[model samples]
Target: MSGSPALFDAHLHLRDARILPFHARYVKDALDVGVTACIDCATRPEEWAMEVSSSLAATTAYGLHPWYASVSVPNWLERLECVLASDPNAPVGEIGLDGIRRVHDGGTAQRAVLFAQLDLAARLGRPVILHGARVWPLLLRLLEPWADRICAWQLHGINFSHELLALPFFKRANAWFSVGGGLLKPAARLLPELLPHLPLNRLLVETDSPDRFPIGGDPLVLGQHQLLYNQPGNLRCILRAAATLRALPVDELAEQTAQNARDFLAAR
Candidate 1:
């Protein structure tokens, strides 16, 4: 694909591409949003085959996520290694710790599994599309050794606090922030501070289609009440909000971010 400044969604989940209508609608929503490429992140190990087989994008990140943590996760790690070794093109990701929710198995095993993928990515030389919840510290700690090895690392779905960005761990890492409908949350007003520091190339846009939604409560909005029913197409609102915060024209930022994503995948 030629490098066009069209919008690019760096993250998304396509569910199961084998399902016909799901794939059709997912692709339609992405196109409607001008998304040039969407990274479908898979958490379940058994879902990797579906993810790989289903992804229409030339580039994608494949790995087990903490959400599917179990005693068998380690074995899936081996399976992931096999896929990566054979293809060696897919970025290693959708892998990280989520300590905030129902992680009944605890993080010790999760960390071990996460680090193993990190090590594999480093040795093989590829970028990583990450998932970090309250586990930012541990995420950074696990990533420390592999920082230089990363082509580009993205923190999916957050406008992180300065403290996390200020830490020494991120000093060597190239950080990309993904903002979507979730930004509509009152807490997401933080974008004004977050967008300025991140440059165009480092900036990435994503719909996380049929999956991404703002952290805001579903209340009837004032001007556009239709938005109360959030959908993937609403990513346009996210780009508009982000552009306003950065003080740049929406079209310009959209093009730049799209290019940024294409360049990111190229690096791999």
Candidate 2:
């Protein structure tokens, strides 16, 4: 965290040529720019190994995400167990409930799958990076018992305003919010209000990459609404934006967030 320091994108998705060509270039760009690390999220058993294989220097999480909500519980669990048995080092995560998205999942199914992953992680004594949307309340309810079991919990791609971050559970729990390109929106300045609501020690930055960007680099300021893309390289801009919002030096902002990521990883 001294000198130029390093940027660790807590969450990202980069598909290889065998899987998809678009993300290969994106991954190269991130590595070329010296991103410290990115956690490649696996959304299904078929894609779990790809997530682990895609990590050139970053890490990976094995489990089915919200999109596979309709995917039967036993099917995904078998795949998760296979990945775990093969790679005991791989963590189980990027799994949770989502009410905001149009995933073909039932509320009960989402809860069931998420709980199963948590149980698996607990047995393995590994950590997790959660993805909870409108179902935050439900997520907390299920995760309460295992609060100390997870290594980390990340709320991905959120545009949360200042007032919505007032949950007391977050203060007592072990989790962090991974803010993505949502901060690039025109009303981004409202982010300052969000900083005060959390434990302050538990905050992280991410691009969520390809999906968050979709288009290409457009800039977080004037072009926030230009439909620009998101990437690991853009995380620096996110750091800068956060620094400005908090009225702190850029280096300090980067250092603090880096520590937060470390703490999240180590706490598990």
Candidate number achieving the greatest TM-score relative to the actual structure: 1
| Regions of candidate 2 where Cα sits further than 4 Å from its true position | 1-3, 16-19, 51-56, 103-106, 158-168, 188-192, 214-229
TM-score of each: 0.82, 0.80
Cα RMSD to the true fold for all candidates: 4.8, 4.7
Please give the distance, in angstroms, between residue 223's alpha carbon in candidate 1 and its true position after superposition.
25
lDDT of 2 by residue, 178-260 (tens): 77666666655545567656565777888776566622243222223432445677777777766777777877777778778
lDDT of 1 by residue, 94-201 (tens): 888886667655677677777777787777777788888666666777677777777678777665555566766678876667766656666655555676776667
For candidate 1, list the clashing residue pairs, or say none: 12-208, 181-214, 182-214
Q: Give the clash count for each candidate.
A: 3, 4
The local distance difference test score of each candidate is 0.66, 0.66
Off by over 4 Å in 1: 1-5, 16-21, 51-58, 71-74, 215-232
